[model samples]
Target: MNHKRSLVRRTAAVAAAGAAALVLAACGGNGDSSAGHDGHTSKSPSASASASQGQHNAADVAFAKGMIPHHRQAVEMADLAPSRAESAEVKKLAEDIKKAQDPEIKTLSGWLTSWGEEVPTEGAMDHSAHGADGGMMTPEEMDQLKNSSGKAFDTAFMEMMIKHHEGAVAMAKTEQADGAYAPAKKMAGAIITSQTAEITQMNKLLGKN
Candidate 1:
């Protein structure tokens, strides 16, 4: 009878050990699953951040590089208005142009810097050569603007600015269609809207509408 009891006790002990092992295995599996879930959650935010920073294409790069010099020329033209314009309306329009474009130039530069692209220097690119692309004023045309004052300056400013805004609209449209970067595309859309309105206003001022 004592031998029989001893055998039963040994059997119970083995069963208990087996049960404990099974519990431990289950706990280990759950722990690994939890760790995997946490790792996946952590990676999701990283992916989102990378997406928000945006991915640039060739068109996006071109838009930023080209717009910088184009904006610089517009700012230059607007700068002359304060000193040379005869009409209060013309002076205000120039101020508005400067206010709108200066920040845009900085934004474009920042995009270039972030993309590992070269930022164009102010007044470095010949505006005249860019006339086919950005409706840039030739050196002579700018010289004429600089030399004029009063009513003549206002009329010239209105006409030239209208053309310049039209060019910007064209570039912005191209960017909107072809650029890959989200921020750049958004900026391009804004340029199209604002510049189109400005073009209409300038035409009215020029008595062309």
Candidate 2:
């Protein structure tokens, strides 16, 4: 009987030890899983941040700086068309130009601000700074367009806008080629597409198509 008791006790002790080992193994497994979860959690924000902020370089900066003033000028010209253009088509085109560029100007300014760069002031440009490459209107040309009305205004506006858009297209192409910022490059692509189409339309309007 004493031997029987001792054997049973030993068996019970072995079973107890096995149970303890299993519990310890389960705890270790849980720890490993928790660690993996923690690692994944920490990595997610960095990935999202990279996606949201993206990367930028000097080319992107120049594109935004140059395009902002350029867009502002286009919008300025567009604003004149509503009051001065005799052609309904010209008025509609001007409205469309304003709608498209106003938002872009805001977006460009936001980018510049985020990058700690200067946003160009409203109605401000150093005409000598960009030269003909910018397709900017001279004060004399802008005054002429503003002072005219009817068919003359329509003709002058379309002609000048065509030139302005060509300059923007050039800048956008440069941005697509040289910029590192993903959003900026994407915007550049959009500008090329939309402005190219507009340029074709303007040429058609001018009977130059």
Question: Best TM-score goes to which candidate?
Answer: 2
lDDT of 2 by residue, 39-156 (tens): 8999998788679978889999999989988999999999998789999999999999999999999999999998899999887876665557788998999999999999999999
lDDT of 2 at 79: 92
Question: Candidates' TM-scores?
Answer: 0.76, 0.76
Clashes of each: 0, 0
lDDT measured at residue 171 in model 1 versus the true structure, 0 to 100: 87
lDDT accuracy of residue 158 in candidate 1 = 89
Candidate 2 structure, TM-score to reference: 0.76
Among these predicted structures, which one has the highest lDDT? 2
- Candidate 1: count of backbone clashes, pairs at least 3 residues apart or interchain: 0
Instruction: Give the range where candidate 2 is weakest over 10 consecutive residues by summed lDDT.
Output: 123-132
Global local distance difference test of model 2: 0.90
